[model samples]
Structures are given as C-alpha cells and as structure tokens.
Target: MKRDMRKTEREISKEEAKDILLKGEYGVLATISDEGYPYALPLSYVFADDIIYIHGAKEGHKLDNINFSSKVSFCVVGDTKVLSEKFSTNYESAIVFGKAMIIEGEEKTHALKHLIEKYSPDFMVSGLKYIENDQHRTTAFKIEIEKISGKARR
Candidate 1:
C-alpha cells in the first residue's frame, strides 16, 4: 500500500531516496508488538538489491513482534542541518513500508555477510569466522519492500 508524501513539494526521486538509504548510518525499524503498541528501534542495516537486511538475537522482543506480524516500516535519514534562527532544519530522509520475512540457511548467510561488508569492512576476516561460528544464535530478516518514499527540505 503506497501512500503519497504529504509534502509533495519536498518529495525526492526514488533514486535519490535509495541513495539516502544506502548511505544512511543507521535506521529505525518499526513493528507492532503483540500488545498492539508500536515498537521502533534503531539498528544497523544493509540495503541491497532492493531489500533491507537486519540481524539480531534469535529470541527477543523484536523477533517476537516480527513473528506476530510481518508488516513493518523502516526509516533512514541521510543528512541534516539545523537552522536555529529560522526554527527549522534542512533534512533528507527515506521511509520503507514492507513485510519482514525471517531468512535462514543460505539466504541468512548472505544477508549476514552483507551486513559485515557494510558495517565492518575492516573486520571481514574475523567477521566471516564469527558468522560461521555463531550464526545459529542470530537471526536475519529480509524486508520485501512494498512501497518506499523519500522527502527532503533542502
């Protein structure tokens, strides 16, 4: 279900939105808890081939929420500049609406590897070893993006 940006004038191209997603340092993943409350948490993620990859402990609140309902939203902010005098700020960001599917086996390995490449490029040797040793203790998610939109006040 794609929704139009409220501020059409501030909307950016899909390509630009993707660029922001790629360069973002971190993103907040939004999910619905079993209690019906919205749960949002910041996490390091990798955006690849139109899908977003995130990993976490196999058992926890986040995973519990995902298992309860696959629907979720993720947001990443690319850049910002405060305008204290104007009482506003210049910013660029992208939001993703998607269904999160837990991945395992080969897909999980690939996603984990991608995360390492993106966040721990300098520790690849050790990262691969870590994945091989403790992959079973962790879980990876693949977000099948249904709709994505970017906005900017630049």
Candidate 2:
C-alpha cells in the first residue's frame, strides 16, 4: 500500500505517523451521510491505546452520519511551513481509516480523562468536576483504527 503514494519518498513509518497524530491539535473527521453525501468537519480528539475518541452534542449531523455507517476517515496534519523559495511545503500528516461506535459509562469517562490530560492538564481538579457535571449531556465515540498511513516532507 505504501507504494501507492504519489511520493513514496514522503511516506513515513507507523511510529512516525502516530507521533504526528499525537501532536496534532485538531483532526478532520469524514463520514458518509445516509443519502451518500460526504461530510467532513474539524474536531478536537484524543488518541489513546490505538483508538481515537471524540465527543460532542448527543444529537447532530455527525452522530447521524455515524449511525448510518460506522466507517470513517480521520486526518491530522501536524506541522507545516511554506517554503516559497523551494516552491513546496514541509509538513507531517496522518490519515486513519476506522469504525466508530458510541461509548458509554466507564469508557466514556476514560476517554474524557485522556482529553483533559492532553488539553487541560493544569486544571485537572476542575476538569474532573466538569466531567461529572457535563458527561451526561455529551456523547462520546471511539474509532477503532483499521488502517493508518502517515507521510512527511521534512
């Protein structure tokens, strides 16, 4: 599959791919709606134990799309710099293909904790409290990654 890339020289190892994923601040999640329309949205996420966790309002287009089909694609672009003189950009990115499912109870909490750790480490106490107060109003999903491909131009 690596040979399929337009520029195989930019293809990166799994470890390098995962590193870019971990450092990415936001990812674009792509899903197919019931009518076969494709929807893509940028969202905050947490990567833990090979699964990507995302949370949002319990009712929405994204959730509807997930219900229609579990298969989804998530893309994360880490760092980029435009090298005008070189007429190219240096960047690191990763794409993930996966199946997403709603997570509940302990699993949901676990995912939330990981998110807090990544985004609000300094406010752990308040984060925990906020989770308890807000968890019920939110919905969490875990994406079980089926295939991951990463590339970098450095």
Candidate 3:
C-alpha cells in the first residue's frame, strides 16, 4: 500500500484484523463478471487462518462471476459511531484482497462447517445436519489471502 498519511487511520495489528474478519460476520464481496463488469454483493463470511470463506448458491450471478475471474476482493467492517460534524463521518473498517477459488469435496464441507460455527455457533448441536445434508447442496469458496489491511478511527 502507498504511504498515504491521509488515508491511514490507527493501524490495526494483524491479529486484530483477523479477529475482526472472523467475528464481523458480514462483508461485501467484489468480483469480476464474464462481461468484464465489476460486481459487489453483501455476503456473510467466515475467516479461518488466512482464508476467507463465503457460501452461496450452486448456481447464480456470483458463481458465474467467480468462474469468469478468480480475482476478487472482500471486506468486513466493525461497529462505527457517527461523528456528526461539519466535514465527514468517522468510522472503522477492515479490508482484504485475495484470489478466490471454488472449494469442493472435503475442503468445501469443512469450510461450510467452519462458517456455520462462526456465524451461528448456536446451531452446532445439529452439526450433523450441515455436514451431511447441507454440504451436498450449497457451494463454498475460499479467498486465499494475497494481502490484508485494516484501519480504525475514533
């Protein structure tokens, strides 16, 4: 990243960024469509290790877009308090960039389970339902981190 003092906020540690990504639950996913158009969609994600996992339909615009171009960007932001001022609003946000790859078989199954645990830990008791039934129908993709950066402001 360029050293732009104006764009930088309180630099968040890598660990803190990972925590935010893992716990934030919701994020926006950006992808390139077959027609060479940029597409951004709000999605729920799970962060494990250095990979961000997203679950979606077996067939749709997102899947089509990813298939056309593996390059993608994902971002997750934490709570923000509006600073009603004359100029602008203050906020905290985290962003990640990576190459997205469609995961299948065991990898996909594992990712799906991890996603469920992160976003809905309460349903863990019925974990078998996810491992067996849901896994067969849904699609999961992993974004292997090429780079990650986060910032926070008061």
Q: Which candidate tops TM-score?
A: 1
Question: lDDT tens digits, residues 1-154, model 3?
Answer: 3344365558777777787787796999999988889999999888886789888889999999989888888888887777667465555667787889899988888888888788678898687586787676778899998777778876
RMSD of candidates 1 onward, in order: 0.9, 1.5, 2.1
Runs off by more than 4 Å, candidate 3: 1-6
Clashing pairs in 3: none
Ranking by lDDT: 1, 2, 3
Off by over 4 Å in 2: 1-3
lDDT of 3: 0.82
Of the candidates shown, which would achieve the greatest lDDT relative to the real structure? 1
User: Which residue pairs of candidate 1 clash?
Assistant: none
Model 2: lDDT of residue 108: 98
Compared with the true structure, what per-residue lDDT tens digits does model 1 show for residues 76-151? 9989999999999999999999999999999999999999999999999999999999999988999999989999
After TM-score superposition, the amount by which residue 114's alpha carbon in candidate 1 deviates from its true location, in angstroms, is: 0.6
Q: Candidates ranked by TM-score, best first?
A: 1, 2, 3
Per-model TM-score on C-alpha atoms: 0.97, 0.96, 0.88
